[model samples]
Target: MRIISLISACLISTAASAEYIRGSDYGFKLWEGAAYTDDESGQFSHCVVSAPYKSGDTLLISFSKDKTLIVGVANDDFNFDINKNIPVTIYVDRRQPIYATAIPVSSTMVTLSMPNFDQAMHYIQMGRTMKIDGRQFSGIYDLTGTKVALERTYSCAASYYDYASAPVQPDAPVQQEGLSKTALFQVATNMITSIDVSDAKYLSEAEIENLGFGAASVFWQSDDLGILAGTLTAHRPTGDLRATDSQDLALMSDFCEGDFASSSQKVSHVEGVSQRELRGICRLDDSETQIITTKTDIGEHTLYNIVFFLNTEKAGEVKRAEATGNIAIHAASYAIE
Candidate 1:
């Protein structure tokens, strides 16, 4: 069971007027006034750290198992809309300004994802202040105690995954069915570079030209979940491609950090065949993106993966539809035949 840490209940604040107190869990620390929600179930479900600005605005850093490490800016008096993408730059100490995009979480709050927590934390620890400059809003945040809070948040993530505490398990082979080894390895090196918009039933048709599948390993829409799919070949015989595929996907998924919230990775067996699946809910502006990745053994020394890019709002009901798998499966099955 997870226990949401409440180091000091009296430190909790119901309003922005409350004096910010110092709070810590694991090893990270943050202003008690900055934390907006505490699950209190012996598990750290949500860890939000914020700071007040001279303009009475609020800057926030939120950590959770299902969302990314996000730094948000909120102002009650501002007429800002989180539905649109707002470009911003972060200036730490005298270092070069790092470019980022802030998506709205509410009418007045906008957040940018911290893809590299270590780098951001390093800046916060040694820098005097962190400044955010957007098209219509700007704020300077104090870095005091930010290092401790970041450390604690990191600890919470490590613990949530049981990374330090759990023992490693040996790789296991996926259950097999009627298909021959040759037929099972379906992924090919030369993949389809361009797909017609109408052919992509699961993707947004409006983004057809702009969303062409480039050779890059990842793809994302400003308002949708990112999609990443590729094939990996083993130089030598690796008896269990399922384990290898799952591990690789895990590493890629963890790169976003907050993608682990409401995330799950497992192997499901059906009709004597096994498929490794990874699914997660990613927080977006006023909405969420759902990422689903599934892998299957197809050919000699090869494994095939199908990664999905879907929005919780639009594709919420159709994610499980057969159309999503029809393209990948029919193509693979035909190629092998």
Candidate 2:
């Protein structure tokens, strides 16, 4: 059944003045599916699966804790007004047009509620491709792996609900204490004292931790140059955790989604810690992505990873060169205080 009448009601109920904070820390993965939590509450929020198409559009499907289903489409070229609602239509394998309203969550993304969750899932799973027609754009998405992804989403939502409804134990601890929030940040910042990022935007400790990274990690985004630079630390493995040549190449291939190459070389020792540098380059449809990563074994049970990523689509040649040079300089200058 088409969900024509539920659009307005859904929007009215979901519209809020409070800012929305999506948690990036994921609980588990089933294929390309992952369950995310609320950043503020740390409670399971939704399970989502996304796929990017060759046309540069991404299709997103999610099941929320409220038992509602959402379908979203995103493209970097889109610049919609946030919170604005626009009429849209969905077509599944020549099925009748399903009318809905799309609410722009960001400048580049819009989401629509699927009132008929079961029917929608059935249609999507049985269909080969789905198409969406918005007021300003239209896109076709392949439905590969959607069946498994949607099933995983349902399973994740159910598991979370069961856990939430379970009785609390009196002796159960609410939280655990670990390292200080700023411990990683302090050490990383001290290690790269020569690197200057006065103009870069720094991510908050909570934000970094929510990204499944170390709390207070030294991370910054350069919007102008389309680069991301970060240093993250994790517990050192008891066994060797170095990536093999083939594994490194596979990682680059997965990220690039096109032709890619990866090479590793030993770098000068830093404070008696042996350093290994990995370089990767990938050619995508409209952009080239480059990665420079330096790995070092720091303190006992601590491994530090310094990474730099640059996208050529948003940066010029000169800017890209400058960014890579800065990455090298930072890696070379790293030293524990």
Query: How many backbone clashes are present in model 1?
Result: 22
What's the TM for model 1?
0.36
Name the runs in model 2 displaced over 4 angstroms: 1-31, 114-117, 162-337
Q: How much is the lDDT of residue 94 in candidate 1?
A: 88
Q: What are the RMSD figures for all models against the true structure? A: 18.3, 12.7
- Against the hidden reference, what TM-scores do the models get? 0.36, 0.40
- Candidate number with greatest lDDT: 2
How does each model score on lDDT? Answer: 0.44, 0.54
Which candidate achieves the best TM-score against the true structure?
A: 2
User: Candidate 1 residues 116-177, lDDT tens each?
Assistant: 65686578667888888878767787776666455544443433331111222578554222
Quote the RMSD, in angstroms, for model 1: 18.3
The collision pairs in model 2 are none
